[model samples]
Target: MLAIRLVTAPERPDALVLPIRPTGNAEGDGPRATLESSLPAVADELLAEAAALVPAARATGRAGEVHVHLRPGRTPGRLLLAGVGEADERGWRAAGAALARSAADETHVTVAVPGGAPAASVRGLVEGLLLASYRFRLRAADEAPTLTGVDVVVTDPAAYDEAVEAAVVTARMTRLARDLTNTPSSVKNPQWFAEQVEAAAAGEPDLHLRVRQPDELAAEGFGGILAVGGGSASGPRLVELDWRPVGARTHVVLVGKGITFDTGGISIKPRDAMKLMRKDMAGAAAVVAATLGAAALRLPVRVTTLTPLAENMVSGSAFRPGDVVRHYGGVTSETTNSDAEGRLVLADALAYAVADLKPDLLIDLATLTGANAIALGTRTGALYSENDQLAADLLAAIDAAGEAAWRMPLPADYVQYLRSDIADLYSAPTQGAGSVVAALYLREFTGDLRQRWLHVDMSAPSWAERDDAELSRGATGWGVRGLLRWLATLA
Candidate 1:
């Protein structure tokens, strides 16, 4: 975790990061007027010197742009001009990330807060700084991160206290999600994943955790989960985390696909695709982390997180295509493609949530198909919901959280694609909109609760090929922030 705190002024900082915005001039040049006027006398001088060091053509104050000036004998040896395009929340977030990346070797740096910045911008900046600084790797002790603390220099330190605090918790939880998703499959089997979640909940007084082992899973009707895990020696488990506060008005149940490592079962993925299969459990990581965030924030709404853990590996006992498996609520799905196993495990959890928990809102997150990436690209997720209000509200929260997602239509006409002759539905359709078919198939398990349910196909967004803004290079922890933001609205 990064030590982020607000201070009245910089006290002999090793480096100074001054936020700058475009002046809207023809050349798209330097700092905004408010930034220059707000900085202290010393910082004002440093900004001028920094501007002289870098040409205006090179540093146009565009988002995530940085200009550096080295001071020979100054108390702060380095002066960085961080660009916040238009100085909005998104811009501030980009600037914050750029600052963290630029000063990766520094122990501490002072960020000059733009005067009269709103609480949203403060939160965005802090979230970006902390999130972008996240490092996850298995390395020698000598190769640890160098950057440790950030000091935000503000006029009144107490003004943005709440915003800073909230961003800290949100960023930390997102990092937790990333840590879970990035763990290698060799060490992150079904049992190990459940243990990590249990340990996380152990510290929370309001959070209750229950794990259903293989026997318990079989005793209860979780054929879908069992079918997916039959191939792996690690077996399967179902984890339930309940956070119910006194006088909560709404209950939101979150189901996540927890395939610890997906080898595509009998239908094996190519070598390239299987390399990153460790992150197939990204959805489960997100929901589990978000539920913990809700508890940390003390949100007034109740949240129950259900994660079905399994490893889809090829073996003699692996489930095959044409195999009809009965899910938790007696709904059966004929497996059409063994590779499409995420929706199978998710189906059991969703059915269980609807049948027993009866939550007011049901949302499932999964890396269900590559079609979602083909439709919306790698950065954006596809959202499908039966209720317009729920869709609108979730989209709003996603936007405010600075995440990208487009709500796709759940065409009733597309329901025909999921028809299975041998069972209630087909786990994977032979032909159609791959993501749409996947969403519609899961909707079958919801029964009459479809109206309250929303499906997020975040397969692409959950893993990043490279770092961008607040997202790291590995498991991006995509849905956690937006879900937490939506929960806060309900609270």
Candidate 2:
């Protein structure tokens, strides 16, 4: 974990200065200097020189850049010149990201942005940068270097401290979620995964943690979970984390599909596609991470997280496509495709949560289908919900968080696609409405307890190479912020 610190502008001495010089233009009229003049003064000559060189540092045409300056007899050990491109919020954010990346390997670093920068905008920029530079290195043998501490110097210390503190906490939670998602299945199987959740909730007075192993799952009539996980040597487990604020007004139930690794079972997936199956549990990671963040922030409502953790692998004892499995709530499903198993595990978890915990709202997340990726591409997840208001709230939350999500209709007619000849329903529909079918299948398990429920299909956006402001190349923690924001708005 990185250590963060904030330094006030008055603390920096006058001996340090950042002279901004514009690049791509002639002598006296450079945009860099024009922008720099709008910022607070630096404390050292070397810092001033580096600040002046930012405009000419790079020609990416995107935003600002940062230059490092080290000078003797200065108040601090090193100085950073941050470019304020066009003096806009986006420019400041970009510059902050660049600075964060530059200092990722350092123990401590200071960012000197102009005091005139908006308190909200500066905090947003810093938060965005920290999010973009996060990576999961748990599987690596060598210790990866990371930024330990950051000091953001601002002119109006009292004005920006609250917002900055909020941003820092949010950023830390987002990174924690990303780290869990980015960890490979080899190190994060069902048992280990549940252990991590336990550790996160160890000392929280308001939070309670419980784990259901294979035997306990069977004892509790979680047939769907048992059926899907019976094939893997690693087995299956259910994790339930609850945080209840005293006399809370509203309760939110979150369900995540924790497939530690997926080999596609009998209806196997192609080799190329199977390589990324380690991220199959990204949705679960998001839910756990969001729960931890919400609890840490001490949200006013009660929150419960139910994760069905398992591994989908091929073996002699693995469940087959034609197997008929009984589920919680006395519902039975015939497995049409073993690859479409996330929904099965989630069905049991969701049923247990809705029937047992009885929250006001339920939100289930899974990387359940590739058809969702085909529809939304690699940037957005597909959203389906019975409650229109809940759907709208989630969409607005995603928009505010700057993540992509498209609301999908739950056509009542699609229920016919999942009808099984021998059993009550089929796990996967013969018709090609893959994502919708998966959601519909889970809806059956919810029974008559129809609280506001949402199903997010995050198959495509889990991993990709496209660059963005708040996300990097792989294992994007897409739902962390949106979930947090939504929880913040609940009754």
On TM-score, the leading prediction is 1
Kindly list the per-residue Cα lDDT of model 2 for residues 172-231, writing each as its tens digit: 877776777778777878998998898888999899988998998888899988877888
Pairs clashing within candidate 1: none
Candidate 2: regions farther than 4 A off: 10-38, 41-93, 103-108, 114-119, 138-147, 448-451, 466-468
Q: Let me know the TM-score candidate 2 reaches against the reference structure.
A: 0.86
lDDT of all the models against the reference?
0.89, 0.75
Candidate 2 achieves a global lDDT of 0.75
Residue 265 C-alpha lDDT in model 2: 87
State the lDDT at 242 in candidate 1.
97
Residue 352, candidate 2: alpha-carbon lDDT = 82
lDDT of 1 by residue, 1-491 (tens): 77988888887577988766666663444433223346652455666766565454355677788777777797688888888887888888888898889889898888887667788888988999999998788866647678888888877778899888789888999999999999999999999999999898887788999999999999999999999999999999999999988889999999999999999988999999999999999999999999999999999999999999999999999999999999998989999999999999999999999999999999999988999999999999999998999999999998888899999988888888888888989899888799998898898889779899999999999988888888889999999999999999999
